[model samples]
Target: MLTFFALVHQEDDSAYGVQFPDVAGCFSAADDMEQVIRNASEALALHLEDGDLPAPRSLAEIKKDEDVAAELAHGAFLIAVPLISFTGRSKKANITMDAGLLQAIDDTASARDLTRSAYLASLARRDISG
Candidate 1:
């Protein structure tokens, strides 16, 4: 899971526009406020197709930049967009955990019709995004 900071702006009577600072030439737009995040996510996915994603900078670090600071001084704002890039391949790994926690994870996964790995991955995604 990866997260990117997007600069968002909207002019009077215009659609909202979003751009990723770290990803040059990648952008998206939506007429409604509610659709901004979804549109931006799709735009990022399409732009990054078969391309390596650059690591995201911390919010503090990003805000320190002159251009971003100028945008913030105006009406523009920052939004965190989670980017989950799946390579269409899976790899196995091993880990250690407490027995009680493992049992609880198994029970929850069974109730949700998900495997332990799936459940854990979902949890990680939610945690990072949230």
Candidate 2:
């Protein structure tokens, strides 16, 4: 897993803006803080979809940059965003779990009109990103 540091800024009446110093031209925005991490991850994935992945700088290194330091001096902040890679391929997996839990998962998946695999994958993605 690769994690990149995102610089976030918000003015008095605007949405939160995100920028990745390591990946040029990759950015994201969210109306609130709760969506920042998820939006940043999606933006990064889309930005690198057809390009080579850039190596991420360590948190220490990023915090040392003059521009980043200046931003931090202001009200801006930083967040670690995980980059989840997708290969566009699927393979079957066999696993064991409690029957009752499996039934609940099935019910939830059905209610959301998603397959069991899809629901599980969504949960995994959220967990990994957070």
Candidate 3:
């Protein structure tokens, strides 16, 4: 699963917080940035579940949002989150390949001008969507 990073800025007073970009809505204090992040994630997850996804605006659009600028001026930390990637992250998974298979993977790597590890990784993710 591909997860994006979320940067958070916490206020010393813990009163009134703001989220990054124009994507996540601004948050009022009563909670710290961590709480804000948690809430934002929950809200995002709920939105995704309901299929009420927001159109992903480019970074430029985000830069032009006055609300975002105001929030940033308040020392809000940039927090990136894996909105689309969360669904595929399984809590636990294990893969066991036999030695012969490993060797075959290495051979395939040699044939493809890629390292064995790279070959195995590509094999694992051959069908993954971008």
Best TM-score goes to which candidate?
2
- Clash pairs for candidate 1: none
TM-score of 2: 0.94
Query: Which model scores highest in lDDT?
Result: 2
Task: Estimate the Cα RMSD of every predicted model relative to the unseen true structure.
Answer: 4.9, 1.1, 11.0
Global lDDT of each candidate: 0.86, 0.93, 0.52
State TM-scores per candidate: 0.66, 0.94, 0.43
Residues 3-104, candidate 1, lDDT per residue (tens digit)? 899999999989999999999899999898777877787688778977887878999988998999999898999999888665678889898999999999
Model 3: residue 34 alpha-carbon error in angstroms: 7.5
Candidate 3 residue 94 C-alpha distance from true site, Å: 7.2
Per-residue CA lDDT of model 3 for 1-130, tens digit only, reads 3232333556576554434343455333326443554555544454456454556555566656676666668775555544533454445446688999878888889999997666765554432311
Off by over 4 Å in 2: none
Per-residue lDDT of 100 in model 2: 100
The runs of at least 3 residues in candidate 3 whose Cα sits more than 4 Å from the true structure, single-residue gaps closed, are: 1-9, 13-39, 84-94, 97-130
